[model samples]
Target: MTDSATSVFEADLPTLDYGLTDPPQQIYPQFRAAQQAAPVALGPIGPEILSYEMARTVLRDPRFVIPPGIHLSAHGITSGPLWDRVTRSILNMEGDEHRRLRGLVSRAFTPRATARMHDTIGTVINELIDDATARRSCEFVGDIARPYPIPIICALLGAPREEWQQFSRWAEDIFKIVSFDCDLAAEEPVVLAAWDEFDAYIDTMIAQRRRQLTDDLLSELIRIEDSGDRLNAAEVRMLAFSILLAGTDTTRSQLAASMQVLCEHPEQWALLRDQPELAMRAVEETMRHSPSMCSTVRSAGQDITLGELTFPAGTFIVVNTYAANRDATVYDDPERFDITRAAPPPILTFGGGVHYCLGANLARLELSEALKILAARVPDARCVGEVPWKPLLGLSGPVRLPMELCR
Candidate 1:
């Protein structure tokens, strides 16, 4: 949005590891305090783009590739099922191969498709709140956040809906690999164990779907695989796993973060309660202000230049959505968390280009609906105890949110 003719060079850059080492609460504030565009190198995490204009440039350009495999390898998770699982995902894919796989399944994630689940999502959240209605208090994370997204995503994939806790646990452990707190080498067992269970679960589901076609995404994938038009059985399995992994805990964290932010802004919470229709814009502000995804990692496939700066090939960098979302150069009052702002510029929370999150529509819908119900039902909800954060910036949210339940 702010396409100023500013130029940046490594010599003048800050040397922070982005949010890796700072206290979670200081991430954005520290970014705002910095005079440089970004760190010369974010320690082992690589360089980052902090300005709104440069972040957009790097993300939309085809030369900056999503390189999960290389990042994981650098962290000592060189090989195993965990490595194989991430490296083969749509997250790590590129070029024609990426397009081919995405084309076959993209229809299921479209806005129209996700919109159909809105009422269903509302039903689930209402039921979740109903279950917690009698309690004097509840751990917001475990009671509400964890169960909220599980059934919706599972139902989307046509998996067993009753296994919400199982999937939640798997997602929690598996997602740690992306968090800065994760001890990759030490976490191999827990992460792989989750993958193994998820793999077997899909194995059985695929077998059943093969016998009878359903109207779900998995059934669609199986049909394509059997047709032998382009997809293979392994691809189908990984694709299913990828969707499940992507949609589950990430959405959970988002809902939790949304609730936390709203807790801090009770007047806005009152507004959402009084006018439920404002849910969408309220959730958008939540994302722009306290996005679950703080940054997106990328690697330059070839030497690339931005204004007066030129970066060599293999340079890993991040589109610092956390920083860019609050760039004073872009928003009139960037630090203000107001939901009623008109025509807010595009947020880089979901990133851009072909690597943009496929489940973004659903995730947004989930959070908005969750907020709608939450505001109506828990209007007086307040955090009664210390709120533990996820220790790292990304996939960022409160680890455990303890809140008083309204009767």
Candidate 2:
């Protein structure tokens, strides 16, 4: 695979987020318009990257797998801190290993399991609303969106709810790569320290789970028997790490974003308030319109044909989910935020195929609970100030979403 470089592509191309810059909505319209004009655009942001339909092509092509390339290694995306123990979970593994790990986690992330958590999730949502109401105004990202995902994840993993704060801190620090560069000279120590702390936490959990069995995902994974294929200690840690981080960060952002969108479109809020069944549709529509993720990177495994272009093996392809969801061809009046639209299935927010998000069910549950609580309790909640957003291009989320509580 081609290593990320400083100079390889044309300079005329508009440079996108390089771990900096904000206003992705504006950036996206310009980029999508360009891609629609020419599907295969050379990298302007970093190295010789292929964006647009080339992204869809790579995503659809079976030969262009996600692992074993510059995308995975250069990015330092091991399952968890214990790199050796769990080398082949779904997110990082290729071939048989990938399928095997995915199958195990898939069971825990089933529709039934996610559905069952809603009662507890609703309780959490209510508690958050109660807390917000006491304050009259609060930072939704820190107060609500931040805490909502952890307890559900803790419940699923069978971890202690008391330890949720520690997990939250580690997860936040670890994912700050979105805000700060991992490759920076001064960042090495901080990243390494965070990795070490989380790795220790997972190691301790795995060791504890081994001794005392329970119904949590870690214990369930420990009990799994594939005869010839079983998860080792390191693999278990990474799997847990991946699920916790991915599950928490992405959902939290979207949970907060859902509130932002609702606040922006008070009319949509009124419709959902009047008919709560529309909550799910609004969640789906909101995700499609303004997803939490900016883009996902995949390395071209074999020489692949994506539409009109031919990508060589090892090409680092940036799948701009934001662009794909807003494609005028796929979405009618794509720019307009209309939850009432009769949209088709398979929204791109959780992604698609084998790589689809494992916690998508829980995410939906969280959003549903939040909206239900907001509609019932904080119907008059509105943005108190301009939403403070991180400028990182790869992942765009509100750093602080302050909202006023109205009776």
Task: State which candidate has the highest lDDT.
Answer: 1
Q: Which segments of model 1 are wrong by more than 4 Å?
A: 1-10, 15-19, 35-45, 179-183, 186-190, 222-230
Candidate 1 global Cα RMSD: 3.7
What C-alpha lDDT values do all the predictions have?
A: 0.77, 0.68
TM-score of each: 0.88, 0.83
- Over 1-407, each residue of candidate 1 has an lDDT whose tens digit, in order, gives 02332223334567554445453566655567652445332433666677887888888898889876765775777777778778878878999888888777775677987887887798899988988777857888899898787788777778766776677778778777665666788888888888888888888888888889897777767665324565666777788777777787778887888898888888988989999999999888988888777788888888777765666677768677777888888877887888888898988888888877888898889998899888998889877788766634446778899888776
Model 1 clash pairs?
A: none
State candidate 1's TM-score.
0.88
What would the per-residue lDDT of candidate 2 be over residues 1-407, giving only the tens digit for each residue? Answer: 23331222322444443334665555664666565655444544432232434445556665756644232244565444433322334565666767778876676667776776777788888888788899898899988988888877777777787887777777766565444445523454565577678778878888898999876778877777665667888778778777775787778888887789888999988888888888888888888777777666676677654333455667666666776677676677777887787855456667656677777887887887778778778888899888866543556778789889886
Q: Which stretches of candidate 2 lie over 4 Å from their true place?
A: 1-20, 46-56, 67-90, 176-213, 226-229
Which stretch of 10 consecutive residues in model 2 shows the poorest summed lDDT? 1-10
Best candidate per TM-score, number?
1
TM-score of 2: 0.83
Clashes in candidate 1: how many?
0
lDDT of 2: 0.68
